[model samples]
Target: MSDAYNSSWFAEKLTDRSIRGIALETSALIRAGALPVGAKLPPIRDLAFSLGVSPATISEAWSELRRQKIITGRGRNGTWVSGDSFVAKPERLASVGHYGAGVLDLTMAVPDRALLPALGNALVHAVSTEKLNSYERSRILPELEADVRRTWPYEAEAFLATNGGYNAVYTLIHALVPPGAAVAIEEPTGMRLLDILEDHGARIVPVVCDSDGPLPASLRQAMLSKPVAFIFQPRLHSVTGQTVATRRMAELAEELRDTDVLIIEDDGLADISDAPRQSLGRVFPDRVIHILSYSKTLGPDLRLAVLSSTRLIIEQIQSYRSFSSGWTSRILQGAAAWLLRDETTAEGLKEARRLYQARRDNLVRALAERDVIVPSGGGLCAWVPVASEPFALVTLAARGIAVHPGKKFAVQPTHHLRVATSNLTDRYEEVANAIALAASGG
Candidate 1:
């Protein structure tokens, strides 16, 4: 690499604080072979001096590339380009290789199936004993509606059950967010939701987040464009595992109240947060469509979630649901309602929370021992800053471990990897050992 750092691309890309354009440019060079195999990256100080940015920023970019296996740092040997064979891509299915061989799975987010008892029995009962022969009667069963209200804590009239959390989000988008309308989401957000929102005709707008959550400056800019809604995981955010601060939550509520913007708060793992805050729905119930699911708490197979809004939005969304799903399955709805009321179900949630917290604690402690700074725990995932996302990913894969590259969650490039801890049951020690191997970059 030349001592004369190319300033053009870095300056242009650094305009967006959250988007690391320069790092991405460097990644492309590595991919295209312009940065030859075993070639060294420019020193951080020299690169920063040339690019007119802080050395720490350049260090972060280099670290992310190292983690992804695009570059290798051999201590005083300096960072070198990983061979072309090392520039591998991740799998289509997320979290496939989160665990090393002979280790517990800590990278996936599904709950233990054993915790939730005999859902099949409940499903059987729902199918055999329903007296509501009419579609309307079965679909809007009083018992089912009561159950939805209990979990959501919204007026019974304003709630509806959906196929799953994803379905609930699609329903709201179909009913409220018009095609091509601007929709703002936190950068490094959930990929599944991002794809769904785009498919439903949303013009994506990303709001950058910090330790405190979405920066107010980002929100201020996003609101200027008149987005239809702002989607956020207010409780346990997906990849970063950072909670939305209470002060920022109040500020956001006030900001949205003064505009026509709606807030879609995904509280999928609300029960797991250390300090579970009230839903944005509770603060401004009329303008927020709150979605919650038993997937993270119970298990993904449950495929049941509640979507609640003001009576106005509920009536509007009901029309869309009728045209789309006709109605959520009565049998499934009954089963979810029954599950929520079960004392065993509540106990399972408490157990899941404890397990996840412990796993995260173990992960942080392990990573810290290796000189890796881990983000504070919000839930099952940990966003650990590293040297090069591609480098780390490849090195880990060779050692039979896998992690979600942080760039997948980014609206653009930011040098980090989100290491999930949910799958690490009794074998977390083995998983930690594998991570240590990757950190060693052998």
Candidate 2:
């Protein structure tokens, strides 16, 4: 690491974007022993000066590298090459798909595509009106801002429209958590988040849940001992469709107020709910990081989500977004905004609520018919208490169905399973048959 290397060669290489340019230059540098493992990158200011790009652009490039797990930032400690084996990209899916082989996908919480309102025609019309140029130019376009206000009205300044609910989690985690920290999550949550936390070098601390929600006692205990970030899918909680009761939300906030913790509210399947509960941020606005997407309400392919927090967090995230792509997709945001404004979409959501309610009713009936007990909630999943997790999982898999075992959700077992009710089709008999067989120890 010489001054010349810092000022010239590194500057030229960092500014280049071609795949070949990147691969060739990086490979050449590595082979020539220029870039090595455990090497420290120059500060964004110095690097930006050398590359002749804005510091924001250099920071975005660094974020791209960080997302790839190519580099690790230690905040004041500066950035260094990562020592972790598995690298995670922003759009990468959890490796949970391998379990899907030979198994019916009763495990996924995917919404029915027919339920999403058809607003593509309006989107196309809006895109032509918006006159987009490139990724950088369209991020903060007027229509996208209007869309954000229309869909989710708040006093936030910046918005980063991501691919899907899961991508929303990925981007936010990358922005909030530094490498080698701990993130607190509910015991027995969606496993994808656990993978994301681990992939980003944040250890997962399981905060126990009582009848109301995350146990205040357990959260306080965890906070007292170590630095941990809180992650929860507040509305339409995945795996288990459990909504944190609004009254309990106030209590949870009180428990967290004295501590310095980051709260990530993963409202992934939020659109499915009708009644408004006080958001955790409303309780502790400065400490909360809220994320939501249309994956559960709109189609899975619709790939749009929103992130919001206090003004400081919003600006910090904007700093990251500014360097990366600068704004949300203008075309997509315009379409989504139009959809948000559409009465038809609202009607479709009403119909979807009815249909999903019916599906839940059907599952409840099926469970009652077979003597299997399930908890009541407004989301698309059910938390079923069972005798054995492994036995239930293997039995269901053998019967051509896939259900997430409770142990997957917990750092330790409580002998419960989360069965997603959203995937049920018209085959009520088939689902009933599978539940009965699993219950009878098949």
Clash pairs of candidate 2?
A: 60-323, 139-327, 184-229, 188-409
lDDT of 1 by residue, 3-26 (tens): 322444344434433226666777
RMSD of each: 12.4, 9.5
TM-score of 2: 0.74
lDDT of 2 by residue, 317-350 (tens): 6666665666666666667667677788889998
What is the number of backbone collisions in each predicted candidate, taken in the order shown?
A: 27, 4
The CA lDDT of each predicted structure is 0.70, 0.68
How well does each candidate superpose onto the true structure, as a TM-score? 0.72, 0.74
lDDT of 2: 0.68
